[model samples]
Target chain A: MALNVNVLREEFPILHQEVNNKPLIYLDSAASSQKPRAVMQAMDHYYETANANVHRGAHTLGDRATQSYEAVRDTVATFINAKSRQEIIWTKGTTEAMNLLASGLSQSWQAGDEVIVSRMEHHANIVPWQMAAERTGAIVKVLEINDKGELRMEQLDELISERTKVIAIGHVSNVLGTINPVKEIIAKAKAKGIVTIIDGAQAVPHFKVDVQDLDCDFYAFSSHKLFGPTGLGVLYGKQARLEALPPYQGGGEMIERVSFEGTTFNKLPYKFEAGTPAIAEVVGLGAAIKYLESQDRSAIEAHEQALLKRAEELAADIPGLRVIGEASNKVPVLSFVMDGLHPSDLGTLLDQQGIGIRTGHHCAMPLMEAFKVPGTARASFAFYNTLEEVEALFAGLAKIQRMFT
Target chain B: MSLPNLETFKNNPYGTETAIDDVLENFEFLDDWEERYSYIIDLGKSLPEFPESEKIEANYVHGCQSQVWLIHMQDPADGKIYLMIDSDAIIVKGLAAVVLCILNAKTASEITNTDVEAIFEQMDLIRHISPTRGNGLRSMIELVKSIASQQ
Candidate 1:
């Protein structure tokens, strides 16, 4: 069945609002998606009824909170096909998850050991590795991308060396919108015994992600991007891989036994989750996953592709407008730079017209540098966005070009 | 006390003749954001050609979405400050022009004394000038003010 995007739009209350005297056309979902009423209501319901600390409460509300919160672990494990709930770890967001993995994994790194990351990674993916390398005297290596914004898969063989400790890459390019061939990359890394970490922050939203099939040791994503609440993310690690590493944080939840000499850490997922976690956010994420499961994901994917196709077609007609990333496989993200207009100017003008698009380096400065443009105006579409909104974006761009050029 | 290309700074007419009041009046004539932004873009285009050499780290204004370069010189001859600004984004450059118009060609105390936020508020451009936009207009104004205070 064809996805009724107009009906889907009703689920997201934010989509109906007006900005700058015009109906809001939210195209910055890549930055952060607009939340649905279900997700919001779930969070509100959790706070109203089951608001209590998890794993410690003897009271009824405690059991309810713990049950709902722990249930999300099972939901997420199934969502990504993780081995068990033990592999699911709650985090502040993908950034913190990367930091956890990077810090925990880097403890074993020695001098001259290498960590390979793609040029297309968000700073969240890159910076943590750099900091890890700084601490361990490990060298951070680059997996270069071609001019077409696709990873040079051939270079991966050459880039992988005997001393390569970890291979961290994004499953999708946040800026270029290129859905990277991470499965292939992960296979090579697995063969070499190098731990593979996939940044799935941008990928999990647009499509289904099966971590086991991909064979990636670690997969990290934020709940906000997945139509859940903010300040919550998930790190799905292979049970063995997580158990081998030291605990990421030391706090009440992550503790097993405390003594003056040393403290033993909790097992698997709890070993990483130190503090009192975002209990409400965990419940909300469960609802988000349920919401996604309720939808026809394949249809949503097709609809998003149609939106991108329409955007590309319209972009072709606009004089001086050039789509930055033309990778054969991508999500519904249109990143473009005009001949004479700066992206910030385009972004500002688009905002005035009630079109919310992302402008600037998009936290992928290396990719931006490779593209040889300062930045690109990005209009990222979600499943709820209508075809008319796509048309309005091009219309707004045309109006902006007429005004400036 | 002096900056290179003093002649370049003195020739620009943003704060000297093109006062903030004139800009406010021109903005008042425009009805909508489209017209106002067009006028702002025009104002950006009117900026004197900034020397390519001066677009260096020393003059770069941080915290903007677009790359912005701002250089100011207090004229020893006239006892007044002269300012020049540029940005990769035309709207930001236009915003820089607005800042230059209000704060340029003034004495140290006068430049420091100007409430650029008030002027922006009056023009209904408070949103653009907000620190959140990261347009560097706020940083530019802060830089101008700091430069004036140091003088």
Candidate 2:
């Protein structure tokens, strides 16, 4: 059966509001998705009934909080098809997860070691590795992308060498919406014995990602982008790789025993998750995953693709408006630049029309530089977004173009 | 690069001819956001031609979603500050024009004392001046004030 978008839209209460006296047409889901009522209710329920710290609390509330928090690890592991729940380490967000992996893995990186990252990566993926390189004298190599906004896979062979210690790449481009061929890259990196880190922040919201099938060393995603509460993320590392690497942070919950002489770290996941975790956020994320599990995801994917198809069709009729990414495989994201107008100008006008879109570099400055555009106005879609909303966006754009001309 | 043309800054009529009161009255005349924004965009279109050479890194204002360049000169004779602002985004340019109308051709003390925020609130344009908006209107005001103080 087809996805019932009307029913799905009912689940997100924020979709029914009006902004600037017009019905709000939200198209900025790539930045952050609107949380479902179920996710919010789960979080509210946790705070109302069981509000306590996990792992160390002795009371019944503590036990409930601990159970709720720890169970999400299993959910996440199953969601991403990781081998074990021990591989799921809680993080503040994908940025923190990347920082953790970069700092921890770079500890073994020798001078002149190479860390490979694609040009299409978000700043979160690129900056962490760059910082790691700066600290350890490791060299950062770029795998370039073609004008089509797809990674130039041919360059990867020449970029990789014996000294290449790590390969970090985004599973999907946040700005371009290109679903990268990461599984192939991971396989190649695995054959070379190089550690692989995939920034799955954009990918998870759009499709199913089986970490074990991809054979990636580390995969990171933020809960906020996954229809869950903010301030929580997951870092799914291979069990062996995580066990071998040193702990990223040290604090209350992460320590096995503390003494003046030396402190031994806790087991697999706890060693990296320091202090009190985002307990409420974890519960929210678990609820979000459960909500997703209840849905027909393949149907959702089809609905999203149909929205994109209609958008692209309408976009082509508008003169001098160029869609930025033309990759064959992409999620429903439209990054475009209209001639004789700046992106922020478009953004402001669209906002007046009660449409929300993201303008500027979208935190992918290097990608902007590569495209030779100051920035592009992006309208990203989620499953709940109706075809009517897509039409409204185009109508708004047409009016804006007419005004500018 | 050549120094900024003092005559261009001195002759600009943002504050001197186009007062904030006049702008407020015009905004009140407009009924909806579309009319208001159209008026603002027109104001942006009326901004004096900014020199391309002046658009260097030194003149750039940070924290803007769009690129913004601001240059100021204090007219030695009148002891009033003169300003020039430019932005790639039309809305930002419009907001910058509004800022220029408030701050340009004012004495250092006068520029420092002007309640720009209150004026923006009165004009119902408080959102544009917000730092979170990332349009650089707030930063432009800061730059204008800093230049006025130095003068």
Candidate 3:
């Protein structure tokens, strides 16, 4: 089933505008995806009519807002195929969720306990654990990646010792686009009683993800990367884990009862969500998920893969252009570094031609260090990205090659 | 592999020499951003060639969108600083050239007194540049000022 890329492109109004007198070709979706009309309209509708502080007011607007907001919990639960709606917690983004989990978990970990992470994790995943280790005296063990950008599964046994407390990693490398073998890694962690966390920020946008199927203790992703608004992400914890972990924050709506002497916390999900949430963005996320559900996901994936292949084929012809990662199973993220040109130069020149691509360490400095480059120019695709857009990017790269080299 | 040859660059063959007034007047004449952008890239074509040895880690400046390096020396005779800066990215190299042209060969007291940010703002380049690049630009200026203050 072929998706009509033209009709899909029409759904995102921002994509149609001319940027430097040329049509906009956005390849920076990995940083944050552009919202479609459905998502924007849903947020607009929420603000226009159902604006109210949720779960507290008894008025008509309040009731509407509360119901709409709570319903999205169910949407998120189903979207990730979690066990229950109560397991889904609203967070600022993947960064916040990881920080919350690390802070909460480190309190229980003893000195010298090990927390395992990979070299390919985004700074969001790495920093939190480092902070936690700094505070708790717990040790952090890093799993190295091979030259091919795949995790060295052979070294996992040595890294995971009896004192291992947690194993946190990305489901897909933001820089490499390699789909990690999380299920296998999670199973190994589970056998040793180490808690597992999957940073699904890059993976959720491109393919099907089932938290239950993966059996990860906690799975997190940002909504903006999935064609929704910013300032919100979903953290899916197994029900028991949520119940066991202490509240990451203290404020209104997260408490069951408060007295001068003592305050008891609220139930699951609410315990982690403190104060008035990003209500409109949550509504927008629900609409984004609904919009995704309407599309044939497999067809979208196939379309994206085609774009990746086209980009890679073009890269092969460019004399000094080196495509960074070549994983067997991957998303539509193509990163490269030309011999004479810097990634930043490539990114700047591409932007002049009205193409948007991300060029830098991608907040994955360790991965950049591991790859032995300052940064890479990455072109990440969403389902709606057209082959013509890929062609436009190639043309921009060619122009950059002509002028700089 | 390197920027323009300084000998040829100083000759002003293209009249693309980035004098403060020349930069201002040219930017003023170019009404549209597309034209202004190509001109900025053109500005990069005049930066002096950078040596491979000076590209070491100690001279490297962090927080830039590009890999930037700055190396400087005080001229014993004039009591002025001679600054050499480079970047892997062409636009940033151009930006470095712009900064170097304004501040090079100036005494520490003179550098501490001049408001370079105002000059860039006067050019209306602030709004066009990315935030990270803005930080990079400021960082370069900060490095120069700190070096001046130490003197």
Candidate 4:
């Protein structure tokens, strides 16, 4: 259970490689994590053994395929501690999930009803709400953030009015890596009888997420970020909420009975899952969760924190290396901009030394606007990341400085 | 984020169409991608000074990995539109140089008729630039073409 990068690194086949004649040092986990052998095999084995259209197949492989597919539903349910497997609806990923939620919520929201979003939200959380508001005649309000990039929790009362219909926010900021006060925020919103939607795309990758503990009405996350295959997402909704909301998409699997007159919709989760779902990806996600449960998450958190602290200490060495998002609580996301070097230039220079870090606005342009810069070069750590990788980043950065200046 | 003085680009060589041909020749001479990357970055060092005052939202391209500002002038004598691009990043600036060397000083119709992607292919830049940068490059070209077409 102890965090061992050397041992864990072997589990990831992609990690043991060279880039630009140097060992690959990947710190872009915030974007996507490298998959372990288990996840890849689970998906591959599913295709090789049980490959058929699920829920409709009646033959040998069909029944086996359906069983394997439904088994992952139970796996995800336990992974998030959902009340029942029926609450977990499959989508393409977080973006599709957001769009689905927005479209469904639009049918319920009335004109002039207020939808609250935060300043640090990724476009996934913000744009969908805006479109929902635009469609429903509801108004979108923003919760502000302070200097440290932490949401101003003090202003929550002022932001939430009687007309506030929903409070949609990110559980963890993708850019700042701030672990938001989501539990507290959910409680306050619940007290006011406001619907709470938490974007857990960033949170699910780093720590354990219990929907019951958070008491959120809806939670969304992507499997790819959790070291699983892409084109798969999980959206956990309260059973009652799922029943009340209209279906996001209408297709073969989502219908109970299709008629030219009127069609009856399917039950809770299937109603949201429109067409043929990502069966192999669902299997991969189950494997990713199983792999995660095998580790001591607390130790993973500690290892990541150690890496971040070491990077911060190294920041003092670079004369103008400005660290952004100094949130008191965070995962392992380190966003910063050098005094003279642009983020893309820094990212390119680092890439040459076989280090991969994300640069630019990172799909959060408003956050960049608020920070008064175009973008920041970010090196986000994961459990597999090591102290040596941190040192490599600094060495590459030092070389970049030498070349540029 | 103020940029350092780019006064060295006063007599910039990459401001004309012939510069594209020059780049094509130089790219042909390079043996590997690393040398080409270095060559492109060196092009960035020669960016002309874009005025601080012109760095406003009106001139800004919305969807770029780095901050990209574009300014242009239409010559009455030749009916050609001369463009200048600026970015905070070195490689992006180099990309801007690549763009300008092909499309700058051409009339709007001439710019539209120009095979920009073909030129990019000739340099084999499609394989070199990152996907995000490739998107940014496409966005810049689109912005340029859309604006030129409006005139």
Candidate 5:
């Protein structure tokens, strides 16, 4: 299956706008992808026709809404190839999803139990675990990355021991785009009877994910990065583990039998969903999943690979432009710093041309400390992005260099 | 006609597109950063309708180029929220005017649905700012939404 770039471009309405009298060149998909017409239409259709609340009503619209809402669970279940739809719990994106596990796992973990996380994790994955470790008196062990931004697997192995209760890592780094070996890491963790949680926020949108295949204890991702609406994501947990854990929130939907005496929680997914979920966003997420399935993902990956190669080739010759995270396995994220120009300054110049890219620490401060820079300019890619945009970005960077000089 | 100048969006009482030509025409007339700085400061002086009493801690924007205070009041007569903004930086104050135009006198949904990038194009606003300042603008908008979503 090959990606049809032109056809895919047509689906995203925002791609045609002009910026600074020039066509807008968007290269910040890592932050968030633009929604296609299908996703937009699905969200619109839901609001227009099926605006009723899900799972608590007896009316026809309610039934339809509930079915559509639950259909997304099945979609997510299949999307990640989870063992069952029961394992897919809707969250307020990956941040909340990771926090849920951090807080939830803290209940069972003892003070001396260790939790291992990578230095490359976004603040979302890191901070919650840090808080959890602080609250529970558990040890927080950080795995260091090499200069090229690849996680030192030998160092990682040395850190994970019997005392290590959980290993938290990102599948693909948000800043460096270093695709971590989560499957291998999970296998090792499982061998040691340790729980593993993978932050799939950066990975799930770019590649196909199969939770069962990876055998990870928990997997999380956000909908916004996958060309869907914000405020929606999934926390995929194995059924046994999910059933064993206590509910994160005490609310209307999650309770099955509530009495003055005691409360019995609902099943796997609803037990986790304590309040009214982001229904519209979830519907939009389903539309996004459908849109992605319609496309040829293998082709998307290949196109992105070609773009990454081109970006690397063009940037390699620049005297001061040193690409960060030169890992063997990486996605199409290019984080770089030039000698004379600050990354922030370069980003400002690039924006003058309406070239949208992200700069600063990318919410990975420790990783920035490791690199010994304030920050790097990051240009992330999605399937909708094109080679022309890449060229325009470089052209903008060149113009920026000349202006600064 | 040439596109709107940085000063046009800077000192306006509202974000209405006026004095675009005068600012753009005279943009290059100023030679150094000192004159440009004064020009930007003058632009800040033209900021409109800021309610000073509303500059409380509740409305302060995080991760901004300057300390910006924002207050949103829902008008009982028409369900629209009136946003009054102030910032420590003169340029930031002018930038706040740019944000207020589309955001002020609008419903919560309107603020959320507004195509900020489109507004930036119409005003040629985003092309001139630093990236951190741009992100700061985004952060201000996000803060607005966070408040609006609750309301």
Candidate 6:
């Protein structure tokens, strides 16, 4: 069946609400996606019917909650083709997930050990590694990006070596939407026997992620970005790699046994997941996955691609508007700078039209520094966004452009 | 030509922890941009006490639109971090205040260990601010943590 997203849009009641006396045109999915009714109803249902802690309870509610939570893990494992549910660890979001790996892996890294990242990484990916490098004598080597925001793979190959212990990269640039050749990046790292971590926060929602195909040692993404709930994310690690790393936190559930002297760690995924998990959100995520599975994946992609093209065409025609990243391979994310207006000023004006677009560095300040601009106004797309919405954005931009010019 | 009076700008408690949600649930309740600007600046005015000496170059927050100073004083007895903050911009000062209440007076370990998510949830802070302003607030929290780590 051909899935019409507008039919699904009615499910999200928030979408219908007017902002600033105008209808809401949400264009910031890269930051966080709007939850469909299916996702929302699933979350509400969990709270209403089966709000109980998972795995530890002996009651009927616990069993049901545990089932719902594990079902999402199964969905995630299958979605990414992970070897087992043991490979999936729940986290607060992508940032915490990345930090989990960083905290767990830092003890193994020596001062001279090399970690590779790119200039285009969100602060979440960059700062954790920087912290880890600071603790150990490890050195963080950044792979440069061209003006189009494409990762310099040749530069990456030169950077990785015998001393290189980890290659941390974003699967898709959050600011630019440039899809990195992570498979190629992983293959190069694998040749050196180095571990690879993919920040899939921007990639997994927009594109299909087959972790088995990519062969990345660790992959992390937020559930909210993939039309799921906030405060929940997934970190997929190869079982062996997870087993090798130390426990990220000293907490209730992550331990097999604890004594006055020392603590024994639990099995693979549980070792990383400490304390209470986001049970309702995980159930909501399972529903979100089920909802996405029910849709035609290619159709969604095609719709977004069309929107990107329309956005590009309209954006380019604006007299003073310059689209920031012009790469051949990109998602529908567009960052732009107008002739004279500050990004904040532009954002405020756009809010008046009830069109929401993120302004500033998009948390990739180094990329902004590389581009030699203060910041760009970023508008990202999801499957639900339409060409008409893109037109509204351009119309809004034209007003700002006229004012500035 | 008459310009709007800056002093008359009152900070409504709406997105902050203290906002009267029922009375002014939406931004549109305010008549014009001038009123909203005044309200936001007024929100900045509510920022808690920041030590004057802490205003030195060392305490300056890097990414803010205004000059912001932060000083972390450790209470020798309890080992909690006492934060005093100030900012040149009214809105930023308000932002600093909101941050101080959530973070200040907590132990270094508490500051390090607390789940910021819960505090943000209680404050209902993120949804109301401009995305950039929200990011700046996060940066301020990060700066606070960086200080606590040093302490």
Specify the highest-TM-score model's number. Answer: 2
Question: Any runs in candidate 3 off by more than 4 Å, and if so which?
Answer: B1-18, B22-46, B49-60, B71-81, B106-135, B142-151
lDDT of 2 by residue, B30-87 (tens): 9988889888898898888899999999999985478899888777787888888898
Q: For each candidate, give the interface RMSD after superposing the true interface residues on Cα.
A: 1.0, 1.2, 2.5, 2.2, 7.5, 6.3
User: Per-prediction DockQ scores?
Assistant: 0.85, 0.76, 0.43, 0.47, 0.05, 0.05
Clashing pairs in 4: none
Q: Which parts of model 5 have CA positions greater than 4 angstroms off?
A: B1-151
Tens-digit per-residue lDDT, A127-161, candidate 4: 99898888889999989899899999999999999
**How good is chain A of candidate 4, measured by TM-score?**
0.98
Chain A TM-score, prediction 3: 0.99
lDDT of each: 0.91, 0.91, 0.86, 0.86, 0.81, 0.79
Candidate 6 residue spans exceeding 4 A from truth: A1-3, B1-151
Q: Write the per-residue lDDT of candidate 1 for residues B62-139, one digit (tens) a residue.
A: 864798898877779867988889998899889889988888889999988888889888988899878688877788
Please give the range of 10 consecutive residues that has the lowest summed lDDT in model 5 chain A.
A340-349
- After superposition, the stretches of candidate 4 with alpha carbons farther than 4 Å from their true spots are B1-11, B15-42, B51-63, B69-83, B98-135, B138-151
TM-scores for chain A, candidates in order?
A: 0.99, 0.99, 0.99, 0.98, 0.98, 0.98
True contacts kept of each: 0.92, 0.71, 0.50, 0.62, 0.00, 0.00
Q: Provide the global lDDT of candidate 1 against the true structure.
A: 0.91
Best by DockQ: 1
TM-score to true structure, per model: 0.98, 0.99, 0.90, 0.88, 0.77, 0.77
Cα lDDT tens digits for candidate 4, B66-87: 6678877776666777777888
CAPRI quality level assigned to candidate 1 from its DockQ score? high
User: Model 3, range A35-126, lDDT digits (tens) per residue?
Assistant: 88999999899899999999987799999999889999999999989889999999999999999999998989888999999999999999
Evaluated against the true structure, the overall lDDT of model 6 is 0.79
For residues A141-194, write the lDDT of model 6, one tens digit per residue: 999988788987779768977899999999999999898999999998898799
Model 6 preserves the real interface contacts to a fraction of 0.00
**Model 1 lDDT at residue B149:** 87
Q: List the residue pairs that clash in candidate 3.
A: none
